[model samples]
Target chain A: MATNTEITSRDSSAAERRGAGTAERRGNAGEPPIRPPVDIREDGEGITLCADMPGVSKDRLNLRVDGNTLVIEGTARLELAENEEALYADVRSSVYQRTFALSGELETGKIEATLKDGVLTVRIPKRLELRPRKIEVQAS
Target chain B: MFSIASSASDSLFDELWQLQQQVDELFGSWTSSSGGIRSLPRGSFPAVNIGHTPERVDVYLFAPGLDPKTLDISIQQNLLTVTGTREIPTEEQATYYRQERFSGEFRRVIALPEDIDPDRVHAKYRDGVVQIGVERREAARPRQIEIH
Candidate 1:
């Protein structure tokens, strides 16, 4: 949900990419979720978001947007044969999740998402009225 | 008197520096000269997980947004190295609000515990993760000997 603070700060550069949510819900499947690194950019049209999610496939990836809340979730599968024994381990969790309370100015219905090379790209265009427009100046 | 006091402080500082290094090592994974920077105290590109079996070692490296043709994996004795380059997609006239993904050449060299057969190494890249399986040295086998 968009709060007054979140709505007013939507124009700020920090809020633009903070498409990374402040209210985080983690710890599922026995381990804490890995907060996948994300990048956000804004143009005259809307916001473009890219999240790095290695080991995630198209089938395992799930992205949802609801009432200004954007959620990204995926599971990373690591194969270990029956005979293989673990010597060293680092990736403790297979789940990756992130939530973002989006600005009200965005057109959630027009969001486009694509997954490639284990990276997720989500494009949410701004509302037509909210987008920047050039104002023609009359002859002085 | 000042010169002698300064030398004493210098030695003390050296001892403190070594102690700090030891503490860092104890707290993190002593992977190499860089130590444990895998999203811990420090962050490293293409985070990796290594495991072993009776025959071979298994390695999984997580890195997204890379060209498959650029990946290179090499094994020399016990050292295994994976290197590649990730180029940022060109964005014209776009203003970035946040950039966190790593884009550039990345190299990870790990010294394994036992010698590995260089020819027995098998590596595959899929979905942005590289899986490396290396067979241990064939010469290492327990033998039974008769003793009087």
Candidate 2:
């Protein structure tokens, strides 16, 4: 379970959105972990969610919507083979994953995502009822 | 008779070689493990670069167009982990002539040296790149003492 501080902190900042709790268990002699940050912005119509995942190509990425939850997943292809040791390897290729729960007020079917210049953006539109509609008053 | 060989053929060969490399990459998934759960391979991982200075170790990652908020970084037991996910793109009533990019969850883990002091780690994000500065433990720093 995530702590309240963790939830709010994670939700509040661009760097905290992806809460990589692996540091808590680094004591284990296993592997280290990596978590990239994501940002979400909501406007009158919908919310724009952005993520940074480098080295992942269109063929390797996957997105799915299940019930009220949206899931994103991706894997980075190894540019160089194991036998070839790069003199300088500055990019880290790894798996990417994220999940967001949609409220009933949102129109799940209208959600859309796009990957441009290495950033993945998901736009989730709100339901008509949730949006502020112009109310017409009868002439008295 | 004209020369049988032409420059076009040479260029075609170059294109063929590039295409062959792409084809090879398509057949092979980015994943290194058979379990199919992990997004990528393990170890220091290749794409990221770590530089060591006299007082600190600098880690740099090449990531473009990624929102800083979606990134998560953790250092524990001399290991650093970065994890996050990318959503699939959707458009309404639009036809695509060509499309290629991967979207989904990803996790990257890097091993660290024992001389690092996690508490002193500082990170900066710029131009789609992440740079982390980890201060070295006192014992790890170079020291010169005068002979008595």
Candidate 3:
């Protein structure tokens, strides 16, 4: 969970910008944290967000939702023995941060998430009343 | 070994050397770089970082969502090759609005330095990271002198 409480929004960009949460970091860490690649799937029920964030462990992962904003922040770490010294690595920085704004139709409290093999999967289900329901028609 | 940069401003070789230096700074151990002016694919799966201590060469590969047992890491001659396939996690009937994650198969081969001893190699996968340690030959280890 992120307690820093910093939020920002971006609009009218080059591409079609949905009001979804923009990529922002809580604070400056070396090079700016990069936006990990994400896969978004939408069904009639709700939407699923899968983010590829390798080197991020469960202890270091911070996932929280503030109002309509969903924030995914994690610090990727390379664990080495006390005597080991790392000279070079390609994954430029160890910080990963991304945010997504949620629509009112989804249930924020019921979001289910799991971190496995470096991928973060978060499923947000639609509101119960908003979901497709069978309406009974009475004879007038 | 340091390369002498060509003074000719118009030489394409100079540009390649500069690019190599930049990559070296970023990736640390880019020991095998083809000089041809070809763009390295940005989506190379499981990006790796190579570093070394006095006793062993350490390689760390960042790849998430993997079945660790399926990954293959082998050493042939001086080249260390890692091969694996990544299956996209999604239902066939699911409607995808965005797919930016790299999926499918990937093979990453690293050229081990001459001083590394191929016989003493070790690898393990944990928490989405593949770590490898290759010991260096006895002669390659730095000898510290006792100050008289």
Candidate 4:
């Protein structure tokens, strides 16, 4: 079993406020963005990250690694029927953005990601040189 | 290749962010207290959106990574209930650094508008969102009054 360490250093900055002014507003252009919650765990092989981003499809999601920083972004669009009005709303359509600073121990070239059921999982493998190895002892 | 910046401003920004989150939570709990509907606990899993048309009412629940087959939706009287469970991958031995993703079973109950046609309801789960539509009673729909 791979025992992983949890990492919580990543910070998600709030996205722009679209239709946050009033409750009566009904439009898709000005909805505020939401920062989805995330969880990260590290094992002997690499790190795994999971984020909850509902209403986002595969085509609308973007994942990139810049230098030592990893970025995840998703855009969600919500459109109501012409005659429909919001009676009560706790969820809104908006962009989701999160960034994490990567450490030197990780292998930047071997990163992998997947999106399913509105959840995004990212795997960051460790460099072979950094992995622990056992050496045999020689007798004189 | 990371460069170090001023640490003072970073800490200040973090403090401000925390304060803003607290304020948002306070208001969220306040506005959702109306009617008999109970406000969700802070950081509740799977937030929801509810809307209505002249023909029917629509409820959208944001739940990603949930199996559609495992979801249980029921409507009784004027109450709409949604129940489901999400199992975490536990085969890998991991130490907690930060675990924010919600798992396990959860149920959300919503009070429907009056005069809803319980028999005329439909639900669909797609792209991590669950949409439930309940038709309004024919008598409850607004009709244009003609001047005689």
Interface RMSD of each: 4.3, 12.5, 3.9, 4.2
* Per-candidate interface DockQ score: 0.37, 0.10, 0.40, 0.33
Tens-digit lDDT track for model 1 on B36-145?
33223235788877766667778888877787789988877777888899888758788998888988898888777666677888888777788898887766644467
Superposed by TM-score, candidate 2 places the C-alpha of residue A117 at a distance from the truth, in angstroms, of 2.6
Tens digits of lDDT, candidate 1, A27-118: 11235678998889999999999999887776566677756798887777666665554454455566778988899899987788777777
lDDT of 3 by residue, B97-135 (tens): 889888888888777668888899998876688889899
For candidate 4, give the docking quality class from DockQ. acceptable
**Model 1: residues >4 Å from true position, as ranges?**
A1-29, B1-42, B139-148
Candidate 4 segments exceeding 4 Å error: A1-32, A135-140, B1-30, B33-35, B146-148
State the local distance difference test value for candidate 2.
Answer: 0.55
DockQ of 1: 0.37
Candidate 1 docks at the CAPRI level of acceptable
Clashing pairs in 1: none
**For model 3, how does the per-residue alpha-carbon lDDT over A77-110 read when each residue is reduced to its tens digit?**
6655445644544555667789999999998878
- The parts of candidate 2 lying over 4 Å away from their true place are A1-34, A85-93, A134-140, B1-47, B50-60, B66-148
The CA lDDT at A86 in model 1 is: 43
RMSD of each: 9.3, 16.4, 9.1, 10.4
